[model samples]
Target: MPAPSFMGIYPPDSVQEVHQSLPLDPLGPGAADLLAGDVEYRLHYLLQEAKKFMVHGKRTTLMPEDIEHAMEALNIEPVIVPPRPLPQAPFLAVPIPSGTSGAQQQLYTVVDDEIDFATYLKEPLPPALANSAGVKWKAHWLAVEGVQPAIPENPAPSSRAGPSRLPAPTTGAASLRPSAKQHLTTELQLYFSRLTAALIPTLAQLPNLPGNSAPGAPQYSFPDAERHRLAALASVRSDAAVAGVLAYLVRWVAESINKTLMGATGTIGCLIDVVEAILDNDVLFVEPYLHQFLGPLLSILLTVPLGPHPTPSGMSPSPFELRTRAADVLAKLVNLYANGYPGLVPRLLSTLKKALTASPFPSPLGAEHPPAGRYEGAVLGIGACGVHAVREAVWGTNGDGLGAINDLIGLLYPGEGRKNKAPLVRATMKALLLLTVPKPEGVTAPAPDAAAVAEAFGPHFVRAFEKRPWQAQELMRLRNGGGAAEAEVDAAGEEDDEMEEVQA
Candidate 1:
């Protein structure tokens, strides 16, 4: 005879014993084997169903609740057992028979209860078993007269709906019709409503100042609130939904430009928060509509007066601060995505130059100068282009590049036709310093041409430094070519100290 195939790990003897435990007639041929196989199959099926439950709950480990939920979902009624009290002196220590191992003899015990076995058997069992919560099975119609009832037992509404109620479509074309964009728009609106409501408390902290608590007032806190907003936005699973929200934000900023500074700043801040969240998510695929974002982002960055005009007598961070913030976002986008969109950097540079050099309001004195806010935005945008792009812009890749270095130098030059706004001069100096500084180690870029930079701005460099006295010392050191090395050494020492502190 052939050896029995390993159908499963379930033992046939165990199956036979279970079968014999039940009060039944003689078993048919191969009944034990059939029973073992069925038990194995059912156990495997139960595990597979339990796994679906785990995944549905976004869990890694299987829990008892998962199994319960799985059974509930499958419409399987679970068998529960009532708690029973222990009988007094149920087992008694008894002497083992001779010739048994000492270990076996020590382990053996006998039941001492001597109630009538036949009398216990004659008693009827409870109709329904109780669970830990003392819940008992209650009978309800699984289906009544071919119609499923929507009871707690049958929770699915679609399952309860009868065929008679489900009307058949009269025309195939009508049934096959596509949903309108208005439906999508309505759904998006609802999603945004929920999202805004959920995020408002966390993201929109009102200022504590008196008289600032009016309805729909714009009050925002930095970094913390922004972080909360980004986290909330990133948690959204649908890419298209997130994209729709982002598109709406862009439109919000575009429409809010003429609004109050408080309003425009709040909305622009939200836009930047959303962009940061999208970029932070490595799995989020936004490449397809990335270009669509550029227009709105650039518009915010290049807007001449980013916020409402501040009172001449009042002191606050410049209106250009908003433009600067938006410019920073633009720079990050360029650095991360420049290679993918070849024209992006060039277009940005073109737009920035135009903004920087465009004649300012004609004065009664017949003088024209670019606004400091515009100049700052343009300079920061250039700096954001990374070292290589800046070098190429300065020293042409093919002996002919946009003379960005010259333009910047000309802006910085004292007594030049350009207006000498303190902020504009400071920004230009910072941009030049960024361009001339040595590329950090591990960064593969051609070193800035010290000779070319010196020759270009050496004559007027002192005037630029005197204008920004606070940063002059560092700026002069950098321009003289000794600062980068010193800076690197200082940075290395700081890092070493940090490492030592962490180790200690």
Candidate 2:
């Protein structure tokens, strides 16, 4: 059926129910319909106003406060409805007297459970525990003058940025900023800075040195900064207190060696001198960082440097000279530190041994003889360990019943001239020469029998050392020393046999 038009819609039955609830007499038939239309229009008007409140508050959902606000603005009394304790309290399906149709409707509402106020007041509140540890403060540098120092407090360069974020050298005002690495003291920083600066060769017009050392006796040159450099090295060798910057100094020298080894003249020797200086410092305990020195030292001694090889100039030493210097350094290092660092000698021996073998570093592609440069270094490295090592390792028999090194030493091809110069032969001769016994205080030992000399050191060794009488005497000394060691061994075996018999 067509119904009366209104601004908003509300159920006619609902309006009549409200009217009936009032103490006033029920509305007339047409009055209920009119009232409903009026009620719907008023509700919609208030809602339209409430919508403004909702829009002003920037909310999509409407609240009871919005309705009340609309009513207040309209000068209308708002309904007094008690709020439920819980927002989501469920409504009950209260039954009413059966209507004409005898049907009932269910209403839903927020419902709350009953609580005992007396028990609630007595209940303890949850312990007030913190969600995390208490807030605290600490001081550390974020970055000093746009550069970070490698201290424990600061993030590591690799982790914070990337592996490429190396600590760069700063100058002027930037350097003045407190950028000490790992919390180094002010004095160490100054000492280290001075030492490094003084030792570094000041590149100038270097008077060209001997183009190359004369074949047999190699010559060496020194840089203009040799005085300051030597002084720096001497100070480093003696300064017990400089241990704090040892790692940095070692790293600096290693990097310098790598940079200069191929072409740059004179710098390689200076860096090595620095290492010797550090080794000389007896008061300082350097055993811990000694391993870091091996790779660079060996590279200078052995490896055929990559890239274009250049002629020596200024104080730049020849390859032969470098190998000699490196061998001496290794020897000195072993003599000083090997006793304390038991494995130091063995580790060096292993690397040197590999270098000495027919096939060394460059694997499967073997050489009849290891490269001349590497072979010379390895021989010196072994001899540097002292007479005892040379005796057992070089002179002693191997799987082939002759020492691997002993047999090879005789095989080195003897050729002369620059490119054909046999440094390997010279090196082998030097190793044997090192074993020669020193002359007694006033008296001298008679020359060894030629037969015995050949017997002890092999015929090739005897021929090699025959250049000088003193050389031959040293050879005899070496033979005598070997004979004495052999006698001792025999005696030891006899003693063991006697002990076994006595026990029986």
Candidate 3:
């Protein structure tokens, strides 16, 4: 076969120089040129492949690994070549044959004479920098429930990027205000901002809408229920190191409660959510700042006339729902921290006892008890303490809390002390039913008859319980330790009514 033309065109002199190391005779015919052409083609192909990788990597320079990778892709044996180091001094360009009209680029690096290691050690070390402080951070809201406060972290109110659409807080209260002093890292700041924004609602609304007499209409939308769920999950998982920010959270809760109780509409539900999530999170250091939570929670539980009462259009939350939820959260808090803080449950019991039996007369002590509207909240608070509290703390033979429950069953009573409130009577009955919530220490006895229940609690309670057959059966269970009557309750019976659902 004739020598390939492309191979034949390659420089023979170059091939001859390469051939010096080989054990071979002088090239026969165009063999040297053919060998040179093959070498040239391989080198060109390798570089072109490597250049593609460099471009793909979005880099201007090709690396040695790129060449190796190119060889692998092109089905060639790998070559391990060290990277070409940068020149110590600028390169000096030289001509093709020592002197030429046109330039052929040849790189020459400047090199310095070698120095002994001893000479380098004699030089002075750099002046030590005064130790820099480690990284630190703090977080306060730039916008909380859409209301931005004038704080150090936020820009001046006038300096905002554009005119803010959000209204000022109605009561001029800063519900999510950060503490006067704070220390945080970038991560904590981010977490605080996200969690608060997720959990809190706007604290203010215009007193009344313009050209619309709709009282307490909210100015901004809050995050939906699903968003609060995700935020709670994040808090539970990520707040192990959140002790520093606990104060801010507690303060926010307190401010929210006070503001909501003072006729700020539509934020109590959001505030209760925040409280529940904070207490439920295992990682939170709640005890140190727990006292801060109690005041706000108790205020929510025992306050009367919480607004804005359910609207005619059914747009706003009922105060009753908020109180019940707060009571549940308070119970959880007490149950969880009771072992460590012995006085916690007792204080709650004392406050609840007062609210449960408030006097209509104008006595100084009577004034301390919550008004009649809060009677239901108080009953819920007591019942949330569990069946044990109901049996021992509330139940007694000598007209103990049983009388309170009887008198509270005033809907059908003819006496002047009777209360005609359906919600209160239901709450009272639910509390009374707690007596039968089968306990580990329950006494083994027969289920009580109607005569026994009426004699023990009172006619009013028996009347109320008779209406709630399950409750009356539960009373039988309390009379008979772990009553067999409870076993008769099927899944159909387990599905509670709407009132029972709320109470449960």
Candidate 4:
């Protein structure tokens, strides 16, 4: 069957002309329509194949090379016609005079070799082949005698010496100083703009209240922003040069936390998600600058007033929650690149302990007391370092580790020291539970002394048990025997799930 004439895809007259040009007998009746239909089908198929080439090249516009590649893939060769020879110019011969000698007679012929009409009439090459300029390889010294020349290839101007030369103090030395904050390059700015635009809708969709929401707030079973975050970070990870952009973005996020009053907490959470996405990409080489991130991560973990002083209703996450998320990001960084950066673990632990134990006021007469959010952040930070980190902190060569644990436990009970705050108490209980839990195989640490922990913090455990039965059951199991039965394990798993829900 033939396509309708209204389609006008392959005109019957053109098909007939093409058939007539071939060196064959005239086609039978209706043969031109069949040939046109076949030609249309093959053209569509070729175009589809050409589009595949364009997509494979990561290009949006189709090119003649794409079409050629498609033809090659299909084992098809296009016909090439040679150009015709140019026409000869007309000649006019002058007759020799009757009186002139035959030997003296001469004739002149006019030729048109300079201008070839056939060359002008021949088909032109495709733009893809004709418009391309030839590449000429050349080399030159980028720098001469430790000074870069002001060439097209060099970035700096000849009038200005490289950064090593000190500017005169009288001539505005302040302007010569390096900027304290990192600035995104033009390319990076564009990338960041696109990524943030892509993420805005997803971020907006996340409920302001993590675990609790008003009756009308939108609800979701999973994190809706996760996919967007992964895609944005994956783009950065795929390009090595963009790694610096990721670092700059991290610093920018940290600065935002310090500068913004409201909504900084939620923004920080999103930034942590970005960090996780980058870290999760195993192909990215993040170890070189991993140390630089420690400062920002520590600041997030220990920064007081992490959220607004007077947080708006259901608009921001709690200070504890923000710090907890920061701590989680820090732990992941440590676990992934700790060996690359020595003393990271100890420095983080020290910073967290100071924040946890710091008093709000200088003297006892002052009415202000330490905020419970800091303690919770500190406890969660410890737990994020994994069970081995917990054991080392509790039984390492440095006695301060154990002392820190004791201090944390002491905060759970009323005493002459800092009074027990509920948030701190709950956080401490969870941290202790994580520390005492049996680690899986392949970890070479000595088993944690559950009985010793029970004896040391028995009264505090009892107090916490009154409020949290799950902790009490675990403590009893640990004291009676270090092993937990299947049922008890299942119950503990359920309790962990509940805790995660509450934390979320």
Candidate 5:
């Protein structure tokens, strides 16, 4: 037996324990910094090999066998992992031990694993699930049923210079096989089926909540089946086998919120972030399966119950996770704007506008509640992005960007409700105050109109401006002077022209 090389100042006992736990524990003493580091290295290697396999097979799962092969090629047996039983059985659970000494373990139980694949093919999936997480089942079910899309004799790439090869259109029951693709399809279908079955009751009970007296709340309804479907879809996305599918699912969610749901901006932003994670990250690939996965998921986000009110207090919603997701999505969109997707600017701002207007700001009373906080922060961040950066990226000047900033200010300082909007108003105003500091890029400053600026911000707007003395002075100067600094260059050009004429 190869004695595990322990590169540390650890006691011999600790080394023995680590070795006992993981023989291929590559992160011994000086081996690597931690277990995470080893996992990262392994992931990098697996991704590299998976990319290669993708070239040959379009898409393939990087199983333990693939990792083992890569390890052998690298001459590093220390990284090879022995296979454990895969999560195959339905109605099973994965119990994670709790940190507390005697705390109850967390269980991820699968309620219904078995499904008659043939029977599902014969009957249409529930319309709600079909519309929302529908695309997934259709595509995967077709694959399992061994269907193939008709291949054109003269297929062409969508772009002239893009990859010329076309993906085989997936169709009927005949497409299912014993191969990896078929296996992925079956697993996904089973997962979605189980999840949809579990979600029905939770969604059904939400609408009838007593506090949902707001008109929008009752209108916001989703089939309980759809939530489980999304959960299952998320699980599939997390899987290394079909990473590409995640982006598509996210896009679907976004599209559904905007289209089917009619401007459920809060939920849509969350979906956008999911897509961004797939697109912006250098470490991962968004696979083709996503197109199939997302088309239906979009339908679901549209139907999922979402409204302006904060969720009831002590509902125990996951605020941190929700915030992180929203931030991730917003960051990606902002990055795209920064990196030169100028065309996306108008849409980004519009999306932010819809989200902000849909919810009550500073929240009514239970604003600190998990659901409310998540919505408020998400909305505020989008508004901030719109006012602070997206405008600068698109128009590239104070004059051009000011309209966008003004829009945010208007939302923050609505009449009569000025008291309710106080916190949001102050936050937005402060952000705008910072933005007003002229960083005059290439464009000549527009003569500042105090009245216009004040009007844009409403009555409290002047107060926000009062705090920034220098910016106010600059604005005054721009207002007093007819020609911005832009005129000076023309004066100099005229002088040069005269000199050249005299010399000639």
Candidate 6:
């Protein structure tokens, strides 16, 4: 049967007429909704090239200029917007810029986007204002539907508009909005997922490491509480017995559970309670056993879905954090699979794209540069991996994984020039190489449903290569520099020196 159609869904005759006048690609608008958040930047860039095909008064491919204008209208600052206060609950319910009430009767409005800490403090307080917890409260009664009403005589505080007068509570999850709660929960879940995915393959190889059957080292079990203990003992003895495998597996299981329980409010709360329990446990040195899992956790996290909403603090996880963890995971993953498991490459590439583009992150002034704390390499690394991965994966898949790769390219290469460059540029480069290489036996093809990757990426093929041409060139230079010969010489010299020193 044909797909169900609603007459109301069709554009009116007038709209169709206008469309006929414009030089528009039939597919662009249908695919436009996928251009949410930062994806808009990439779309804007694509639009610039597309406009050349458009006729006057006719819709054409979206051009960079068109995208730039759209971005402006959407309040996406090309230069990173500085940190601003989040509109709190009660404050959000009222109109901003408590308008002028004196003689002029001309209505003025406040745009929260225009109000920052400095200007807000400088503005005179409107009449009948209330202040609490360092946040000022006021209301402007503007005309609605051509009707204006005077303030009621001596109205109760709740009757007044603007920041609610109720005392703000300090703790408990109740303080967060439903959206914020889910967003934070999802972010946390994503973090654990990436880590779990990264550790799996390497951990799988651990059980077979040479000298794994050392004294006092207990064998690993498929399903047993004592497995972690056995793994911990192996790590302490620095034995090859357990490898880092079991530790990673434990982490994978834990993160997988977290992912499954994410939306189960009761289950999620319980899982968090469990995490808290682990955090509070002083007797168990969880970090040692816990740390190995970070790889897979990072991998899964990078692949997990994220929300576009902001946290209450007006801050998201720092870009620094995003870049560093992403880079570390990419680097570790490639190293683990370089000659051993190239099939793991596509999976890693898939994870990289998800982490960088799925959720829009805060873009503050300093966000342009590397973030100041840990995980700084995350954005740059992820971007680097994405750019190259998309190009290579698309090619490797016989132009199949192109959808995912392309989507990722849109994410990593949002605009022109280095100043606006995504932070995890290096990681993107590494992932690209990995994605381009053919998968080894036993590894499957890139996920088939990743069509969005190619659609998002296909248009920017040339631009993606141009964005970082030098990096590709340098990689070739390193490969041809008798790479393995130099390494072997260095290894032999180091061994000789060690033996000479012992004889002396």
Q: Whose lDDT is greatest here?
A: 2
> Tens digits of per-residue lDDT for model 1 on 329-366?
77778867887889888887887767766655332223
- Give lDDT tens digits, candidate 2, residues 1-504: 233455445878887787778766546567877777877777777899999999999999888778878977898755553453446545766556566786776665546678997777566432221111343234568888999877898867657642222222222222222334435777777777777877764444222323433445434554445556667777897877678877767767776676556644455556667788888887877777777778777887676641114333344466777778877888888877787888877777777777777553341224453346677777777778765555555554321212354455445542223222456556766765544443447765555466765565555444454554565665454355546434543566568679978998
Instruction: Evaluate candidate 4 by giving its C-alpha RMSD to the native, one decimal.
Output: 24.2
Compute the lDDT of residue 14 as modeled in candidate 3. 82
Question: Cα deviation of 398 in candidate 1 (Å)?
Answer: 16
Candidate 1: Cα lDDT at 388: 47
In angstroms, the error of model 1 at 18 is: 80
lDDT of 1: 0.53
Best-performing candidate as measured by TM-score: 2
Better of 4 and 5 by TM-score: 4
Error of 4 at 190 (Å): 1.6
CA deviation > 4 Å runs, candidate 4: 1-188, 196-244, 261-263, 356-368, 392-421, 438-455, 466-504
Which candidate would rank higher by TM-score, 1 or 3? 3
TM-score, ranked from best to worst: 2, 3, 4, 1, 5, 6
| lDDT, each prediction | 0.53, 0.62, 0.60, 0.56, 0.42, 0.39
Clashing pairs in 1: none
lDDT of 4 by residue, 180-294 (tens): 1235565655665556543322334545324544466566533545456546667755646556556555555445444432334555666566666667766667776665566
- Candidate 6 regions off by >4 Å? 1-253, 256-309, 312-320, 323-327, 330-334, 337-391, 394-419, 423-504
Off by over 4 Å in 1: 1-181, 185-188, 196-266, 310-317, 363-370, 392-421, 436-504
- By summed lDDT, which 10 consecutive residues of candidate 1 come out lowest? 168-177
C-alpha lDDT (0 to 100) for residue 170 of candidate 4: 12
Question: How high a TM-score does candidate 2 get?
Answer: 0.50
Worst 10 residues of 3 by lDDT: 163-172
